[model samples]
Target chain A: MSKVPADLRYTKSHEWVRSLADGTVEIGITDHAQHALGDLVFVEVPEAGRSVKADEPCAVVESVKAASDVYAPLAGEITAGNPQLAAEPEVVNGDPYGAGWLMRLRPAPGALAAAALLSAAQYQQLLDSEGD
Target chain B: MARQTPLFRLHQELGARMVDFGGWAMPVQYSSQIGEHHAVRRAAGVFDVSHMGVLDLRGARVREFLRQLLANDVARLKTPGKALYSCMLNERGGVLDDLITYYLGDSWYRLVVNAGTRDKDLAWIRERARAFAVEVSERSDLAMLAVQGPEARAKAARLLPPAEGSTALTLEKFVGRELGRWFVARTGYTGEDGFEIMMPAADAVPAWRSLNSLGVASCGLGARDTLRLEAGMNLYGNDMDESTHPFESGLGWTVVLVPPERDFVGRAALEPLAREGSPRKLVGLLLEERGVLRAHQRVLARDAAGKDAGEGEITSGSYSPTLERSIALARVPAATAGRVQVEVRGKLLEASVVKPPFVRDGQSQI
Candidate 1:
């Protein structure tokens, strides 16, 4: 089973979002998403200061098998993309919740609340319904 | 429901991630595909190839039957146990399937064909053999395993019966020796020295387990594909199908047009094409960019003016684990040369055209 941290919010597409004290949110793929991709070889993140809408494709994660798109969870303007991922894509496979964070975004007004993102328990239930 | 091989349960026990490949529930990877690919290049790895169809031919005219059936001259097999790789073609000179035929004796021969083409190949061979009174028997009761790498031979030889093991060690490349129920051949798709062993289905699990216990990593189809691609070998459906002929698919070397009068299934159509030269040629592409190349991607060969000279398409492509770069095999216009560009996700990335065999014997050849 994949880990769903109790403090984070998730989208059905498997992007996890964590709110910071500065009113910005950090985003990365969930453990389940990374595990399914298997050994990421390249990551192409959006540029800093770019605007993105909810559920829009903001980045690409490539494994040996195929390339997958990472969707943005909420309407937001990108603050930064992880520079570490350019040289070391495996971080997404190794530490998906921490160093593997894709980008940071400052949300548009009321975007987080309007997004209807799932809570940790709700996300776990969603994963459960997709039985092995 | 997808079919399962004899080693399916063992693969599940090893935590393999299974996928449906040509209606067979087979492992795509056990742990890591890249790791398995490296093992086959540096040390050793074992692959369950039981899904491939094996056929045994027996008749008074077995040799003559093959000479007329295959594009390559099986008459070249003067020594018993010698194997010849050739393409089985249609009357239009299009490839039906590529197979390995092992000459066992005057009246006996063995053939291993691709998994997806099994039924079609069997039916075609049976129809063709009727005139020659040859019996084409599918060895569904047999299973195959390929042990590959620089050290694969020495490690796998220890598991065979003593006398057979000694013979296996001394066997030359592309030769097969039968010991009891086992038929071991010194051949592999990976560009490494190794053996492909075929035995009874019941013996597959024990042999796989023994090889695994000896540190031969268990590889799946994912690694198998990358290894073959790096070796510049062709995958049937990806590289060539009924629409493509051998001369245009980088398999010209396997086609024998010698002795002029020797007629085979596709010789009538291929003869004129060979003399006039094929309109297209298969070439290798080395991408220096960060993106992975994949099948069906469009390739553009350009002239000095940066204008389109000719177009082509990538048949088989991937991120080569050994080269740490993306590479592909494409069928381009016959006169294409120098640099080419492959369009990936709408962006044209520059790539160099070169001869294949990208990696061989665990070393990068280009």
Candidate 2:
């Protein structure tokens, strides 16, 4: 299983969002998402300062086997994208919740997270259920 | 409604995300495909390749039968454990299946072929074998696992009977050895050093757990595709079917016509194509643009006329883990080279033509 920190908030699309004090939320794919895509090779993220709605395709993760999109977790304005990802795509595979973070966004104050998103415990439960 | 390997139950327990691959319900990824792909390149990764068909071709006249039937000469396998890769063709030179024939001696040669093409390959070979008084039997009682990577041999060697690990690794490439009930071949799909182990059905469970304990990552079919693509190996149905010739599929060397008097199936048909040269040749495509290439994608190459008028297609494509870029192996007109463009979903994508085996020993050939 991918490392899912209980303190982190996750989107149903399998992205973990870490909220910063100044309102910029650091974004990265969840352990589940990375595990699903397999061997990640190339990643393309949206430019910083762009506006995006919740669930919008803000980035792309290409694996040696297939290509997939990284969906935004909430209605927000893109603040930054991790340029380090271009040089080290597998960084996300290694430290998905840390340096593998894809992009940061400034969410609208009082706007709620996507309703369909799951908690760490819930996501782990889903994973176990799938095995059965 | 797909077939599953003998180790399917174990794969489910390991959390492999299964997918339909050529009608087999196989794991596409276990944890991360990229990690597993690299594991084989750097460390070790194991693949359940039991889905590939294993056939025992036995008869007194087997040598003569195979020499006349296969494009590659089987006599080279005079050493008992040697292996040969060749295309079994029809009378018109159409491929029935690309298979690896292992010389087991005593009128028994073991052949392994693609899972999807097994039925057709068996029927065709059996029909021809009838003329030479031979018998073809599919050995479903066997299972195969490919432990691949730079570290694969070392890890697998440790699992053998005492003092045999070194011997297993010492076996030369294209050679297989029978140790107890397990037959291990130093051949693999990944362009990395490893062994493809064929074991009896009963021993699979114990072996799977043993390898897992040794830190060999359980890789799924997803990494296999990308690794093979980067290695410039051809997928049977994608690169060539019965209608496509071996010469056009970048495997002309596998065809050897010796003695100047031997006649085999498709020799007459291939002779004309060989003399006149192949119509299309398989080329490696390195994407100049940032996008993933896929199979059946049209590769736009200029005709020999050179006025920008010809058509081609991508037989296999994927993101190359070793190169960290998307690449493809395409079959196009033989004379066409230099820079070529692939039409992927109505978009013309630029790709460079490079000699294949794009990645070897975990390094980018480009």
Candidate 3:
């Protein structure tokens, strides 16, 4: 079973969100998503200062088998993408929720509330229902 | 529902991720694909390739029939236990399938073909065998395992009886012989010294367990694919199919057109194309930049002036664990050489066009 930390918020597409004290929200793929993707060989993170809408494709994660897109969870202006991922993509496989975080964003006013992301329990329920 | 192999339950018990491949539910990976890939390249790994079709041909004229059926000259396989790799072609010189033929004896030859093309290959062979009165029997009661790496042969040899184990150890490369109830061949798809063992279906589970207990890592289709790609071996449908011929598919070496009078199924059609070189040739590409190369990615060739020389397609590609870089086999214009650009997700990445067998014997050849 994949980890669903009780403190984090999640989206149906598998991104986890952590609100920071600086009024920014951090985003990265959930453990479940990383496990499903297997060992990551390359990661293309979005650049800072880009505007993205909810569920927009903002990054790419490639495994030996295939490549997949990571999407923005809410409308926001990008603050930063993890610089470590470019040189060591496998860190995401080892520490997906911590050091492997993809990007941070400053939400366009009230976008987080409008998006209505899922809680840990709701995400777990979704994963169970999907039979993953 | 996908068909299951005899070792299906074992694979499930091992926590393998099952996937549908060519109508068979096979293990794509037991754990990390990269780990399994490294095991094969550095140590030993075993794969259950039971889904591949095994056909036994029997007749007084079996050798003669093969000469007509296969693009390679079966006459070259004069010694029993000698093997020959060949392409089975359609009447129009299109590749039907690529297979390895073992001349078991004077009246018997065994063929192992790709799982995806099993039904089609069987029908084609059976239909052609009618004129020669050869019997084509599908040996569905058999199971095959490929144990590959530098230490694969020695480790796997420990599983056999004393005399037979020594015999297996002494066998030369590209040779196979019947040892008691098993047929062991010193042949493999990966560029490593190993064995491809065929045993009765009932013995598969136990054999797999024994191999595993002997410290042979259990690998799946994911590693199998990457290992073959790094070794520069071609996958059947991905590299070539009914629309492609041997001359253009990097398999011209397998086709034998010598002794001019001897006729094969696709000889007439292939002769003219061979005389005047094929328009497209298959070559290897080594990505010089970041990002992974994948099948069907557009490959752009450029001339000295940076003009668009031609456009080709990647046949099979993946991140090569051995080389720590992305490598691919591509069908490009015959004149394409030097450097090429691959379009990956809308951005063109530079790649070098080089000779194949990117890694051999666990070492980078390119």
Candidate 4:
């Protein structure tokens, strides 16, 4: 089981959204996703200033075995993307919620309400049900 | 469905990811591929290769029968406990399967073949064995484990029966002997020092537990794939099959067109291929760009006509932990090498062409 923080909002694709008072929403993949694709070797985060819709593929997560796409949790205009991921992709594998945050975005107001996200418990329940 | 090996339950208990390899349910990986790969390189790792087929042939004319059956001359295995790598082929020279035949005595020999093509290999060999009256039997009741690494021999020696320890260590590469209940062979696919032990099914669990007690880390098929790829070893389905001959798949040396008196399957077809020349040859490629190479990706090699040889495909590839770069074994034109582009997705990733068996003796030779 992976750590799902109470303060973070969750997407079914296993991404966490951290909203700040300045209206910039930080995005990163959840811990569960990294554990599935172990030992990250390379990561390709979206370029800054690229506008993407909800569920858009904004980055690529590459492991030693295979490559996968990182989907955006909500509609937003990319404000900044992590540059450190290029050299030290293992940071994403280690601390996905903190230094591993993929990108920050300026969302259209009401584009992503708090109600659209799931709580940690709700996400865990969803995972449990999916496993069933 | 095919039969499951003795380690099937153990794999499930360890949360190993299982896939149907041919027909057998085998673990592809347990935790991470890179970690397991590194373990086998630096220290030691164990693999459950019981799915592989073991055929025992015994008769007075066994050697005579093998001379006519296999492509490689078996006269090399004159001494007891010596093993020879050879290819079983059709009369025209198309490969049936590549295998290792270990000689225990003049009257007995054991052949180990790939898991996927076991049935076909057995049927083909047995069909011909009837003429020589050599008995062929598939030993499904036995399970095999490969413990490989730099420290593999020492670890295994400490775990084997005390009386047989010295003999087990004394066994040369490509040789095997019966040490009580276990058949210990000093051979490996990882390009490292190790032993592949075959034991009766009832004894497999105990042997595995004993080895685990000796601290041999259990690895899955994922590690095996990367290890073999780095070692420049060939996988049956990916590297070659019935459709692909040995010449184009980095196995041209294994075929013997000499000794005119000897004739085997697919010789006629391969003779013309050798005479006219094959268009492609298998080579190792190190990805210069930042990406992973995979099977079926197009290789853009400049051809003799000076045009891009429209398509060459990667047979096997993985991120080599020892070399810290992505490497692949690809089938390209005989004239390929130097600068070539591998098509990963839509992008043409540049790679350096070099000879294979990438890492030998824990050192990157390429």
Q: After superposition, which runs of candidate 1 have C-alpha atoms over 4 Å from their true positions?
A: B303-307
lDDT of 3 by residue, A1-132 (tens): 999999999999999999999999999999999999998999999899999999899999999999999999999999999999998999999999999999999999999899879999999999999897
Clashes of each: 0, 5, 0, 11
The model with the greatest DockQ is 3
Candidate 2 CA-lDDT value: 0.84
For each candidate in turn, the TM-score is 0.98, 0.82, 0.99, 0.94
Off by over 4 Å in 4: A114-117, B91-93, B303-309
By lDDT, is 1 or 3 better? 3
Q: By TM-score, is 2 or 4 better?
A: 4
What DockQ does each prediction reach against the true complex? Answer: 0.76, 0.47, 0.97, 0.58
Can you write out model 1's per-residue Cα lDDT over B151-269, one digit (the tens) per residue?
A: 89988898898888888999999999987789999999999999999999999999999998889999999999999999999999999988999999999999999988878999999
Q: Could you give candidate 3's per-residue lDDT for residues B229-337 as a string of tens digits?
A: 9888899989999999998899999999998888999999999988999999999999999999999999999655567779999999999988888999999988888
Native contacts kept, each candidate: 0.62, 0.81, 1.00, 0.50
Go through the candidates in order and give each one's C-alpha lDDT.
0.93, 0.84, 0.94, 0.85
Give the chain A TM-score for each candidate: 0.98, 0.90, 0.98, 0.93
Better of 1 and 4 by TM-score: 1
lDDT by residue for model 1 (A1-132), tens: 788999999999999999999999999999999988887888989899999999999999988889899999999999999999988898999899999999999999999889989999999999999862
